[model samples]
Target: MTTTLPPTHRALVLDQIGQPLRVETRPRPQITPGTAILRVLTTGLLSYSREIYSGSRKYSLPTPSVPGNGAIGRIVAVGPDATTLQPGDLVFVDIYIRGRDDPTVAALSGVHDGHTVFSRRMMHSEWRDSTYAEYARFPLENCYALNEKRLLGSPSEGGLGYTVEDLLYLAVQLVPFGGLRAIGVDMCDRVIVSPATGAFGSTAVQVALAMGASVIAMGRNTETLEKVRGFFGAAYGEDRIQTVPITNNVEQEVAGLSRFGEADVFFDISPPEAAGSSHVKSAIMSLRHSGRACFMGGQREDLGIPTFYLMRRNLTVKGKWMYERGDVVKLIQMVEAGILKLGQEGGARTVGRFPLEKWQEALDVAAERAGPGERVVFNP
Candidate 1:
């Protein structure tokens, strides 16, 4: 079935760095082979959206682009090569797009311009337009269908009863899921998440708990740490989730973590401001023999790794970017199976919603509500 599409739609366009976003009428995206167009229901706003828009974050975004990373939407049309997806299907649009021929070349649609030369070229030449508009086009593989009936229908009518805004948590969950998967977190494994009060770190705790692993949430904020503990501890049992306040002193932090026993895995997703943080080292030192660690943080400074200690302990350390294609499918499955919850059940709440013209307000709210489980979205 094909739906009639308008020629133009309103979008929040970032004309260039350091300029205010403009809500302008733009031509609607046209579908091609291996691509699909979606009527975006909700696009999540990042907490640092203002920094990115103001050139403070230094993301290499192309000029005059619609900037949104991930969204939950309805499929409006599919390209000729498409087989399974159809019009009206509810799906989560993933922004991570890789070059078909050269998988190494990639770009985050509507977000980063790309780090490498090839990725930058791909971003500038194609995949630059993103989901922060009424309608957006995406690679066919990037659109994953959701269980529409179960997600949208009433619980009385055999549905999970989730709002479109609730599904926006998928975007927030994906990053931590990627890092956790990379470290091979398993059921019953004792895991430690450093700086677990932030958006991704807090979600890391959730994903870790959902995987049946016990989580030791470490962070500097006592209030937020307690909030995270209360949120998940209530569902998973207080004993299964533990919180440790990060003192930024390695010996003290390590001593605090040691009281919980050796952890099987240490997952760190610290932000740029957490450079040289003692939490990373403390968490690593707290791991058991043959333990694993995954770093998915934004710190630019080089970390001091205990080279001899890791060798002796047989510890495995790995770095992960966003996520793989298969990880997205698995994550959606986890959500559908009720193994991983969203919205109120998952401790997530949509704190604010804004229209395209109110992008600035949306960004501000997102920053203010930057803690775990707080969501701010655009109903574009």
Candidate 2:
């Protein structure tokens, strides 16, 4: 219960690493002890955020900093070790902080400084300011809550009318729903999402078809893989979605992912210009023997794993990062049980909407609509 207390706001600082993002005025974050205080409304504008603000991705981010990361707010204030959270609730901040006594010490607030020395002193001492700002604070377990009468109430009152820029596609669907829940994608599983079509592999082919799995989606962008198989094949169907193309030719991409069948999970996020892409060993040789793989991309080379065919196909590879606060509370309960649709029924579409002094035309329309459900927000 704390809302009337401004004492200064507006931000977007950055002041270092090739500088040029001022906007100033600060001073509004004041709730410490397991923090809380937000009001940020909508923030996501990543598309490589100009290679992490022009130092060309050296990214340790600890400048005069405010930058930005996951947001979508309205808590206003909550410290004293907040329990159920109050003062207007409508959360989802999670800039992946971690380190309340070493959760292997993490940090991503205002975007990464994490690479240990205790995650670069927890991103140069305690989550260095984020969410571009109009009031932010964070921590309190990375602030999750978000149902606000079924997302901004309406649908004749039963709500789900959604619109906080369609919850900014939960920051691009929480990094492929944390690598398809770290390769345990179940329900009718057959998964395969390779390069799927960028912007987090076309939202990991719509979060592996909203976790009910049945995708194949690979990529070399054959018309954005048939616009991601006609926008998630008209709501998860067209035989549960399939589209291959990445012909770097590992046996013609394992015979085009074995003409769609033996997968059972093989996610691969691939992107560091997909280093030596053979579509990640033809989706780990088209999965299936006890199958499973996850590899959340940004590919820093050397992923040539064929190691005796994953030890004779007992497969199961892992490597997930950036998720688990119960995967942002099960991705907002899979978007409030409507099974994951958000804005334009999940193929998203904001394309641009800045403020906070048009953050360089919102990072150039988030790098020219980064693709796959292109959204580019700010509204701070």
Candidate 3:
């Protein structure tokens, strides 16, 4: 499946931050000595992309960078000495950066000053050809095998039909599960999730349920809560899921869930409107001794957390970034195996669709809430 292509391909390129992505007939990226080329299948824009673009997230984006971190694609070309992959292999690639030989373990662990890859072989890209295009060039170690059939399935009932949204959501929800054996999550753990309607929240609930955790989902809309419940099969039966609408007094809601404070993990994806950074501080107060709370969204201001509470509880506060190459493969498996479900109303459906030519519109739709099961997708 080696891809022999024309000299150039269509891609969305950004010359600067806060600028529109221009569709250009740029030269297809060549395979670097250690890299391979992939024909784009689908790529996901997780919360990090927006953060990186705006300079608010932990990761940085150099000017003239491509915007996606994870994508599923088929191998088109392989660089010299790249024996692990071949032309026509389906794979999911990671977003980490690769640097010249480095001395620290953090380089392999994804900690480089701003955009360097973690390991000497681990690769990171400062926007070198992303999934928003027809083809991408990736380092050999950064790519993982993907099942072509599963990746190509339709979303209709009985099919995985996952979109970039599903993949991105999977990436976001699985961050806590990475890094080594027994990443500290188990089935039936007490879990609390916030900002229940957004794509991130929706994924959190799905992952918690899949992992066998009891979820207490928070949001300001009963309608949205009901929608979420329906997605999990509670609409026809008594809801195993619970919901708390955001009221004027969020502290009260926070206090109410404190009874379950001994929760093993609390996932926060709420915006300021539903639960602000203070909400996480409060969640820390309610956590069981040695419990962990993960913040999955951005906070505009410093969140005031009482040090005494953290010290006494020994709380572990983690802010998730994005998924790694291997995580994406497992997520695709979960979806294909019928462990995870997606859709617009009852199942996964597109909220909006934009051609590659309308890149800005796609970004806008992704940023705003258009409707239920709404996700803006780019079909190149």
Candidate 4:
């Protein structure tokens, strides 16, 4: 927490393609006048690393890019103009996404010319040199002020008593909550969210219920369906929030749940693939003349929705992504206020933790079927 803090630290650096990241001592990242030096506490992996390295997402940075996105840490040094943060401040910083253009970070992150507007504020990060390190630098705008006392204290002392295992759940929940918010999912409107067992699907159910919508959750697992109904409450109950069992006849199931022919909003969070695409197409065919549907999962292939149906029905299609800075802050506050319960509300739960060295394993767990609720994580 001082200027004389060690000048070098270990970072998980990705030096090239098709290679595992290596831990190496690098010059400790410096805090600019409007930036902060963060000693990362935990960082969550986004599933985008492969695309980042392959140059598939055009938005990805060049090689040697750092491979982290979400992180929570403590501020150890603060530059001038970084008045909102001080030494020892517990914070959550998004490393993948660039901060809003501010002169202080431009030079540090190599956007010094100010000519690259998109690079200055884009969501891509230098995945080759990220938070997998002992310490990292963050732009003031990219950093968030967390409830330090509450986050780090004992549960007995009013801390949420949470662990890093809570990240995926938090992320999934934020997806629907933030995504629905992006398109205005209002209360009391009918809603149908499908594939309710996946993280995003479960999140859509809880988010819709929280926003006062009557959610119709669909999934193949009977137990997961029951769990969804129970958690949303019997008052908001299974009847109002029923789950349709997915099968060969997904279209029939969707048509059955959409009796009113359409809901206020429809969510498709399962992997975007053949079965998933058909379900969405069916939802569109059966959606009310003016309803909206959102695609909330990663794109697996091209979505070939019927243009005629969308055009004729006046249905809006939207693609959802990670939370925006403002939305992330709002969600963090919701968690602090006890409004969003990560594990209970359908976020991933930790079944194991490893040192930063096992980041690949952690990623595998996150990518696997991963049991019913297991989320493997790394603590730096």
Candidate 5:
């Protein structure tokens, strides 16, 4: 049932490419069958957005738009054609419309412009964008149902309900999940993740662990490495979770890792600016012969993964774009069923939260690499 509607709502509008986001009261979005309106609860701040907003992300074309990448919301209304989703339904906006087999899927909905990342949805266009706003009207193609009650320790099970904080972690998780899934991580695989300590790396580490693979978490910072180790060490034990401090000495780290075991897969979630640094070559150095390595959400413009390892070590390298709807659904089920634990380090992953008016602070924090497992959020 549709509830009483509101006329206007607040949003962090990005009118210029490099300028700070502006908070303004804009007209509320209208709902149509192919579209639905959500009362945006919380939107995540990705570290990559710092470069994205700074105009440093060479692959991203600038447009006047909202900067939010993903968010959590309750459906307030849906168009007549959108009978699959209803009012009061809780969900996370999974904003990638890529790799869909059906040609007729988004052709009529105006989701993608056939120009941006992977010829997929731009996600920040005026027609369809992020949730850094009080209200959002999104294509049904970008909406994924997240059943909170199904979560372990939910209010129904004498636990606090799945909070907006959970939504924050889930929002950035799609990239890591999609990347790992693309290479088809297996139970017997021993994985190595470079720069596995930030928001993106943290999610990648947790997903790899949950997939039942033995993981070697590598990071340059001792503090962040230990923090990451504590998270995985406690649950999977040190035997299954190995933490290594990265250095320019790739051969030494590669030799050191041999004591634990060889890595079958190398999942690289390093920041784009740091993409071609030591980690790219080091990841290849650590992989076992015929081992698979996949670049997860790294920028290709400045990234240079050396081809020497592929020719010499018999390595298989692959590129994964975004994600599929089935992947998001599977992740949600895993989290709800208690197979995956987000921010399992016994503290909130939130670095900070801001009201819509204080969005600039949130954006600044979102771009910085100041803390471990930190996630910036906007409550609109």
Candidate 6:
């Protein structure tokens, strides 16, 4: 799938923080050793991206850097020893590309930084992390090739086999997928995804459901909740996937959700508006003894939990980062084996789209609470 390398291309550059992305024509990066170029197809507008744009989360990157972390595109050229990834291949641009390689680190410490996980940022170490451009360049390892008819049926089936958008949706799902794995979500667990039905919340709900756990989804909108409910069938009926709308008395029922059996995993991805003093309190109180809770994504206020509950409940609380190569591969395997279900077979839907030029509108929509089964994407 190799093609003639273009000299220049259009990109949405973040020259300054808290400012709108400006369209600019920049030099198309040339491929060096261990590198490849991706013609940006469509990148998702995740909540984190908006945070970076707003100058809230200070990334290690200095000013004038591209703000995107995840996207889906194709490799148009390859460098030395990078023969494994070819041109015209549909692949996912992982936001964080850090995984440890030093034998000593793996031998001594079981954990190592994986954006070491190639970030999808346009300016990662003098390389390109900006997928908002018409052309993006990155190390071969940062890109994971997507192939497998099972997960991606033939083109007409609303699968990745045809359009690149489906592949982007699959890539977006990896964020929560990685978090769930870190929290040890299993079939026997009762998972509660707070503020469910957004980019991360919706993805987590579906992944938990596929893993055989009963999901109690908490969201703010009834329409969005209904869309999540449509993802599954009678696999335990309504009891299997319970949707709760966020309200003043939300805690009354959230505390009772444990009645179906204590919650095993709680994903706190609640947005700012729905977040208040009660958010974390209800989440912690609802969990059973020794439950695992992950404060993954989303904005929340400083929450105070009773010290007695922390010590008595035997709860394991932790934070989640991004995914690894293994996580992405696991998602791919699930799709291929016909185990995971996406939009093609009636899962979620891409509700909004905007080209690179309309990044402002796209960012606004993505930042807004996404409607049920609706996700805003950037077609660069």
lDDT of 6 by residue, 1-380 (tens): 34888799887787777777688887887888877789888887764556667767543443465556467887898777786788878777775544234312110000112232343232334453457778887768778887735345675764445356666667657777888888889887888887676777777777788878888887767787777776553433566888656664646766556556678888876655544635466667788889988877545556555557778999898787655568888987787565675664535567778888887788777767454345678887
TM-score for all models, in order of appearance: 0.98, 0.35, 0.78, 0.80, 0.87, 0.83
Steric clashes per prediction:
0, 0, 23, 13, 2, 19
lDDT of 4 at 357: 75
Whole-model lDDT per candidate: 0.89, 0.82, 0.59, 0.63, 0.70, 0.68
Give me the runs in candidate 2 sitting further than 4 Å from their true place.
9-12, 20-37, 40-51, 57-66, 75-87, 93-145, 148-189, 195-206, 214-249, 252-269, 280-380
Q: By TM-score, is 3 or 6 better?
A: 6
Tens-digit lDDT track of model 2 for 1-380 = 57797799998898887777978886788887778888898888777797789877676778877879888888888988688987788888888888888786777888877777887777776577889878888788888888888877888988889888788788779888987886678788988887888788888888788788789888887998898888788888889988889878789878877987698888887767678888888888888888988888877768787877788989888898877777778888988877888888888878788888878888877987787888788888
lDDT of 4 by residue, 78-156 (tens): 8788767788777766542443444323311211212265543432343125566788776677677777667545679
Worst 10 residues of 2 by lDDT: 119-128
Give a tens-digit lDDT track for model 5, residues 319-347.
76556677888887777766776653323
For each of the candidates, the C-alpha root-mean-square deviation to the true structure, in angstroms, is 1.0, 17.2, 4.7, 4.8, 3.6, 5.0
The superposed Cα distance between candidate 3 and the true structure at residue 240, in angstroms, equals 3.9
Ranking by TM-score: 1, 5, 6, 4, 3, 2
lDDT of 1 by residue, 147-220 (tens): 98888779999888999888989988999999899888999999999889988999999999999999999999
* TM-score head-to-head 2 vs 6, winner: 6
Between candidates 2 and 5, the one scoring higher on lDDT is: 2
TM-score, structure 6 vs. true: 0.83
Name the top TM-score candidate: 1
Clashing pairs in 1: none
lDDT of 3 at 375: 51
